[model samples]
Target: MPVTKATDADFRQLLDQHEKVVVKYYADWCGNCRLFSPKFKRLSEAEPEVAFLDVNAESSPEARKLANVTNLPYFAVFRNGELLETLAASKEEAVVELISKLHAN
Candidate 1:
């Protein structure tokens, strides 16, 4: 699925609608965030069934707080609206593998 920009207002409802969700937290000015975004998008395109959301940490304070994100390029996965894992790295392969394993179980 395409990545959707999100804020705190609709975050819960969005997650409720998807069986599998991946939310990415990043800041526009962060160099690392800039570097990781393309990889994040590629992963989203590869997994069309999963709901992908992005929260701009520098602009969306509410979203950052809701996701409890502390740093740039944070990633969280949810299954059936339940939080499964929150990862700090920007490794696309590892994230994709983890998602595959999680969905399989």
Candidate 2:
């Protein structure tokens, strides 16, 4: 499945109602964001149980600010709406690894 877009309204419901989530903060003009998009989607397809949200940093200013994402392609994992991990890497493998680790917690 394609990555799901999360708006401010849908964000809370998805988080509060789910067990695991991978929230990706990205901007349209960001090269890294472009590169990471498919990889993130692939991961989402690989792990269907984990909810993946793609938020445009430009569009979701509040989410960007709340998540403290100063850079594009930021990654954060949440377990039942609680932050479990934050990753700084842009590589798909690193993201997958981080999610794997966080899921273990």
lDDT of every model, 2 decimals: 0.81, 0.82
- Give per-residue lDDT, candidate 2, residue 31: 91
Candidate 1: stretches off by over 4 Å: none
Tell me which residue pairs clash in candidate 1.
1-48
Per-model TM-score, in order, reads 0.86, 0.90
lDDT of 1: 0.81
The CA root-mean-square deviation of candidate 2, after full C-alpha superposition on the true structure, stands at: 1.4
| lDDT per residue (tens digit) for residues 1-105 in model 1 | 898988777888888999999888887777877888888888889888999898887777776766678767888888998788877777777678757754777
Clashes of 1: 1
Model 1 TM-score, all chains together? 0.86
Q: Candidate 2 residues 1-105, lDDT tens each?
A: 457899776788888877888899988899989898888988999887888899887887776665778677899888978887787679888888878965694
Residue 67, candidate 1: C-alpha displacement in angstroms: 3.4
